[model samples]
Target: MKKSNQQLTTIKTLFLGLMVLILTSFSEVAAQNDPVRLGFIPLTDCSPIVMAKELGLFKKYGVEVVVTKESSWANIRDKVLTGELDGAHCLYSMPFSVYTGVGGKAGSEMMIAMMLNVNGQAITLSNDFCGKVGFKQMNKVTPVVAAKLKAEKEVTFAMTFPGGTHDLWLRNWMSIAGLNQKAVKIITIPPPQMVANMKVGNMDGYCVGEPWGGVAVKQGIGFTQIASQDIWKDHPEKALVVNKEFSEKRRTDLVKVMKAIMEACIWLDNPANRKKAAAIIGKAPYVNAPADVIENRLMGNYDLGCNQGTEVYSNDYMLFHKGGMVNYPRKSYAIWAMAQYVRFGYLKEAPNYKAIADKLILQDLYEEVAKSMKVKVPNDDMKPFSLTMDKTVFDPNNPAAYLKVVKR
Candidate 1:
């Protein structure tokens, strides 16, 4: 009897051990088809992520996904930091903030596994400043803002978040036009609430991603002073930001996710499909704006309001996959953003810009996934580029020198 009992116990132990090993070996398998909760703000650039889940692309790539809309960018950052979210659609400059411990969050290692889209954001001034200001003419808006500042009026301007792309664009736009960003009161507001806040007379102006920019014009609350592309043609706007743990442990899963989004980007680029794309993304659960509000701008038709009237945009209005020009995560752009952070005092001084870019922007992994799908990538990682609106040159080789010139 004792011998039989001993044999049974050993058999049970072996079986359990084998089970553990199998589970551990296929952990990625479990996670790949498991539900990954992703966070996104209600904005047009979030479409790839939204469409990826909605169109069954996430499942097609083996990642069962959930898209939760967040109230603010800060919430998106915090949730991802806490592991409450698996990944997020994020601001171009946001991962840098997370990696650096800026914006009052403990430094969390982050990575940009993919670029979502580019050139669809804008700087908008309140309708009260409508006739008072002109499209793409910050020269006219500067003095009125300056006067309000001098009088100690609220002179409040809002962006989605500090250390976010919108804030940087607004700051650079004002700085180039000789408006002291220091003097003007800058506050953080969520993207969807922008037009409502303006209607309530809460801010003098704001910079945010579409279709809020477009909605503002539609509602007669504000006008786009400038599209972000006008400032820097084809500049990157949003990206698929993932936490470091997810990038390292679930690398295969990340590849799957990236491939799916890249496919969606390809889908988004085709003009023939944009109307349907716009219709799907415009649903209440996604961007929650009218299809017309989102569709027109998504197709490069711009009102350029404050009565500027509707006109066909000549330049690249927005791009998801412009033959990889706007898709690849450029290390140089990250360096330029870091230089701006230093300039704006977001960082005490620039840390190793290259190190940060290398750590946070996973170009190798992106290339691997992109190449598997036969998607073309930029031949060079570093590119020579300058800001169109400000004429500020961002030489990737010498960001510090570029900063010095921009400072003057």
Candidate 2:
């Protein structure tokens, strides 16, 4: 009887050990699928992440996400760098800038996992400049700025961050219009603070993301002189980015996040859904503006409010998803940015464009998620995009030549 009891106890011990192993395996899987924390600035371009969370799209893809509204781009960059956040709705070129050490930390491995949206930003001129020059009349502003310089005064402009898309757009516009970028003083200001700074006469103009630009117009302090699309139609704007470590360790979570965002992007592109997008993102904790303020401009109904009245751009405006390859992380877009950096003296010498783009774009990851989500992507990653304002065709294959022809 004692021998029998000992055998029974051994059997019980084996069963408990097997159960523990099974529970451990389950716990490991559960830990691998924990909630993803994502960050975004309070801007219209952040609609993808916002929509995903709001619509339960993130959960729908078997991933839980918490979207945090950050104070500035710098904060977003730092948190993502330190692994405080899993990913973020970031400036399209920010990851590249960080990687190549132009305007951010040098050699920080980052990836633009998904292209979020395009053409939502604009350059707004303070009311002071409105009396002199108006919408799309970039040629007229030169004389006014020249006069200001003749008076020995500084004409200041503000962008969100250095070596960011806003900076690139502002510099590109100034360069294409023959304005000396060095002659004008350019500063960095948070997107939400743009209008207030202009009101206090701290800045003459600013290039910033949407809702804020529209907010400036509504406040009667400034008018948008140029939509970013006018400079380069359908240019790549904000992106969803993650560092290499997170990508390597938690690719499954990243794929789920991308799927959720891709669905949101598709929804945003639909005209029927844009009103809902405006309403959702315009709430207090998101963009903190009225729905009308974000909705009208978001749908391409532009009212400069600078005595120019309103203009309609329709499908050519800010698009979350359009054309066949709107969200594809094209290497060309990345290459073109480097070319611009060289032209503007931001970089003394051009880095290997293809190599940097390949590292930073995360095309394979995007396409992998796209395939799983049944979203069709381009067969080739490279695309030939044009810069109409400069009248120069940027050959991504030869970014070096592209930079040589651009205004220095």
Candidate 3:
């Protein structure tokens, strides 16, 4: 009886050990197969990510993606920092802003993996300035704004995030108009809420990505004063920003995800594919707006609203790939972004520009993916580029000089 009992105990121990090993192996495989969780704000530029998932490009690249629609840029920033999201369709300057202590902790790292899209954002003003500020009417903006401020009326402007593309656009617009930065109020508002807030009189004007600008015009609450491309043609707007751990530890998966997004970008850039792309992204689960409203801008046909008439953006329309010109995470652009922070008082002085760019931009990974996809990278880093808005030349090599001359 004692010998029998001993044999039964040994059998039980071996079975438990085998079961534990099996469970462990299963867990590992499950984790490896788990979908990458990416977040997106409900804007038109999120197409690359949405289309990637919708088109099964992620699965084709041997990974799964779960794209979550986030409410605010602040929410996206927090979740990306806390690892709640692996990455996101993010503002091009957001990671840099976070690392430099503008809107987030000074040293928190959020990595920009690649450019998502460029030149689709716009500055929308309420009907109060409908005739005073026509499309691309930068010259006329300040006087109207100044008149309101002169009357002691609340002259306010809002952007999606501090130190973000829209904030810089708004500030740069304010700067060019020679508006007193100290006199007026500048606040943060999320992109989707911009139109609603404007309708309820929360702000006089706002800068945000499409199709919110398009939506505002469609709803007759506002008019697009200027598209971002009018400020700087082909300027960087949104990016695929990821957490450091995801970029470093899950490199293979990250590359796959980027490749899939790149493929989607290529598809988005094709004119024939844009209508279908717009319809897909307009569904309730994605952008959650009417397909026609999203399609109008997505196709580069803007109804500029409030008797301003229509304008067609042929060459400078929203670019997703532009045959790789739009996707290469350019360090020069990052330098310019940081320089704007200095110019606009977001930062008192410039951070080490190249170091910050190198640390935050996953250039090597982008190059690897670009090569795999046979995408051409424009060798334009550290070069001087001029904005169409003011013709102020930005030499990436001398950001300080650029800042010295820009209006405060």
Report the C-alpha lDDT of model 3 over 1-408, residue by residue, as the tens digit.
Answer: 999999999999999999999998887667567679999999999999999999999999999889999999999999999989999999999988999999899989999899999998998999999778788777788889888987989988899999999998888888777788898898899888888999999999999999999999889899988888888889999999998887776788999999999999999999999889889999989998878988888888999998978989898989999989999999999998888888878887789998998899989889989998999988988889988877888998888888778778
CA shift at 113, candidate 3, in angstroms?
1.2
What is the TM-score of each predicted model, taking all chains together? 0.92, 0.92, 0.92
lDDT of 2 by residue, 267-301 (tens): 88988998999998999889888799899988898
Q: Write the per-residue lDDT of candidate 1 for residues 1-408, one digit (tens) a residue.
A: 999999999999999999999988799566656677788999999989988887789889877678899999889888887778888999988888767766645456767888989898988888777677787776787777867767778788899877789988988888877887777789899999998999999998899999999998888888888888888888889999887777787787788888889888988898888898889889988889989978899989988778798756655877899877667898988887878888888887777888889888899998898789888988766766888877776788888888787852
Checking candidate 3 for backbone clashes, the offending pairs are: none
User: Model 2 clash tally?
Assistant: 0
Clashing pairs in 1: none
Give the clash count for each candidate: 0, 0, 0
lDDT of 3: 0.90
Worst 10 residues of 1 by lDDT: 98-107
How many angstroms is residue 209 displaced in model 1 relative to the true structure, after the best TM-score fit?
Answer: 0.4
Q: Quote the positional error of residue 55 for candidate 1 in Å.
A: 2.3
